[model samples]
Structures are given as C-alpha cells and as structure tokens.
Target: MSQEFESIWDAIEPTVGDALVMKVRFKIMSAIIRECRLWKVSRNIASKRLNIGVLRYDQLLACDIASFNIDELVVLSLKAGLDVRLEVQGA
Candidate 1:
C-alpha cells in the first residue's frame, strides 16, 4: 500500500505543526527569491538591499531552508520590499 501527502513537507516533517512551519518558511523564501529575480540586481547589491550578507543571500538563493527560521525569513522579506501578510485557517 502507498500513502499520499498534500505537500512534500507533510511527508517529511514529523508532525502537522512542523510541516506548517516549513510550509510558511518555504512560502516566504519563495517570495524573496521572486523579488530578487524581479529586481535583476547582482548578489552583492541584492544582499545589501535585503540587509543580509552575500553568503546568507547565497544560502537563501540556494533554498537552504534549514539555515533560516520563520522570523528571519519574515524580516528578510520585509527588507526585500515585500508586504508580508498572515492568514490563519482552521483545520
């Protein structure tokens, strides 16, 4: 028999809460990456704009999710000129 998951995080995370956190982090990271692409800026300039070091920005570009927490991603998103919003849905 096989089991199916709605998301990759759901299958990988140990619990629902952990999966939710990863999902949120991925979304924020995605938005930041998108903004970076749209800005068409070099890594050094982009990192400066986002107020992060070049290496940290490289980690983000590489989608190194384990290196970042929700709060840090949120702050970085803001510095990238993204308008962050939260919506809570009942499960």
Candidate 2:
C-alpha cells in the first residue's frame, strides 16, 4: 500500500483502514524519534544507517510524521534500533 500522502490526513484511498494506518504510522514514527532523542542518537548517524538523507532523517526526527509514508516510517524505526512487531487480539 503506497501511502504517499500530501497531508497526514491524506490517503490513497479515503477509507477507514487508510486513516487508521496513517495514525498508527504517525505514532510509530513519534515513538522512534522520541527514543532516538532520549538516547542522544545523532540524526546524521541514523540517516547513514538508514541510507537516507540527513535532512530527510532530520525531518523524521523532528516528528514530521505527515511527511513520510508507512513503509518509510517502518524502515526508519528499524534503523533507529527499534523492533517492529504486530499484535492481534479479540476486539
């Protein structure tokens, strides 16, 4: 699913699923950036590790959640030393 959104609320398909995914992606990105800052991790180093531009990584670190897609956030989170996991439970 290509989530190349112009705004955080933007989506490829205006469906509930897309919106939920966007919010989850935003939260995940926020958590990664928060942890990175807490650990004093340099954005430059993270960018190098993620093979992304320093500015782009800086944006990620700045909590610019709306600027990134789901796949990009996942990659950034993994490179930020975070383990990605999914869970399912009765809802």
Candidate 3:
C-alpha cells in the first residue's frame, strides 16, 4: 500500500549518488506529504485558516512538491505523527 512518491523515491535513491543529497530529497518528499495533508484538511472542513485567494492557494498546493520547504515539512511530519530522521542510505 505504498504511495506513488514513496515508490518513486525507492527507485530514485540509489541513482542519487550521494547519500547526503539523497537525504535532502527525502526531506523534500516528506514536506510534500505535509502539504497534501493541509490541502486535504482545508478542503474537507472549508477552513477559514486560509486567507489567500482560491486561485493562489490552488496553484500553491497544486504542485507535486508543494510542501518541499524544510520548516513546513517538519510541521507536517509532526502533525502526521511521523518520526523523521536523517540516516545514511546504507544505514
């Protein structure tokens, strides 16, 4: 039951060459997950938390990597109860 991005990351990791860079890519992916949660919740509840124009919000969350920023990603993972870690590829 893995996600599309998770499967994509599994295949992409080995080709990244550098473990550090690969970890960064994972971090970005984690952020994308968070953004998805925010988008979903807002949509479901019709949240007033979002003040931006609908078009802008739509454009922002529409990207595949919408939540690729570290700060937002950390928040998303925390909210989702995901214990994120920085690990070496082979470790």
Candidate 4:
C-alpha cells in the first residue's frame, strides 16, 4: 500500500499545523532566495544587504528550513525588499 501527500512537509510533519508552518516558511525562504539571485551580488554582499551573517545566508540559500523560524524568515524577506502577505482560508 502507498500513501499520497500534497506536499513533502505534509508527509513528514506529524500534524497539519506543523506542515502548514513549514509550507509557509518554505514559501518565504524561496522568495528571499529568488530576490538574492536577482540582485546578482556575491554571498558576502547579499548577507550584508539582508543584515544577516554569511552562515545564515548560506543556510537560507541551501533551503535549511529547520534552521529558521516564521518570524525570522518574515524579517529576512522584508530586509530583502520583498513584500510579505497573508491569506486565510477556512478549512
């Protein structure tokens, strides 16, 4: 038998809430990474622009989701000049 999941997080997370949080984090992280790439700057410069350390920037680039929290990712996105928005839907 096999199971199908809507997302990787859904499969790995023990609860729907946990999966939702991870999904949000991944979305924000992806936007930041996209902005960083569009800037065409070196890692050092990118880190400085985001006001985060190089290692942290590396983690973001590497998609290390567990290393970050929602608040931190939101701040990083703002620092990267990306607008963050929230949409709520009833389940």
The candidate that wins on lDDT is 4
Ten-residue segment with the worst summed lDDT in candidate 3?
44-53
- Which portions of model 4 show Cα errors greater than 4 Å? none
Which candidate model has the greater TM-score, 1 or 2?
Answer: 1
Predicted structure 3, TM vs. truth: 0.35
True-structure RMSD, every candidate: 1.3, 7.1, 7.6, 1.1
Model 3 per-residue lDDT tens digits across residues 1-91? 7555445545656664444454564665546445556555664232234333445445435643443455654544555556667655673
Runs with alpha carbons beyond 4 Å of true place in candidate 2? 1-14, 89-91
lDDT of each: 0.95, 0.77, 0.50, 0.96
- Better candidate number, 2 or 4, judged by TM-score: 4
What TM-score would every model get versus the actual structure? Answer: 0.95, 0.67, 0.35, 0.96
lDDT of candidate 2 over 1-91, digit per residue (tens): 6546666555544876887787778778888877677766576766787789999877877778679988888877888788888787896
Model 4: per-residue lDDT, tens digit, 1-91?
A: 9999999999999999999999999999999999999999899999999999999999999999999999999999999999999988898
Backbone Cα, N, C clashes tallied per candidate: 0, 0, 0, 0
On a 0 to 100 scale, what is the lDDT of residue 26 in model 3? 61
lDDT of 1 by residue, 1-91 (tens): 9999999999999999999999999999999999998989899999999888999999999999999999999999999889999987898
lDDT comparison, 3 vs 4, better candidate: 4
Superposing every Cα of model 2 onto the true structure, what RMSD results?
A: 7.1
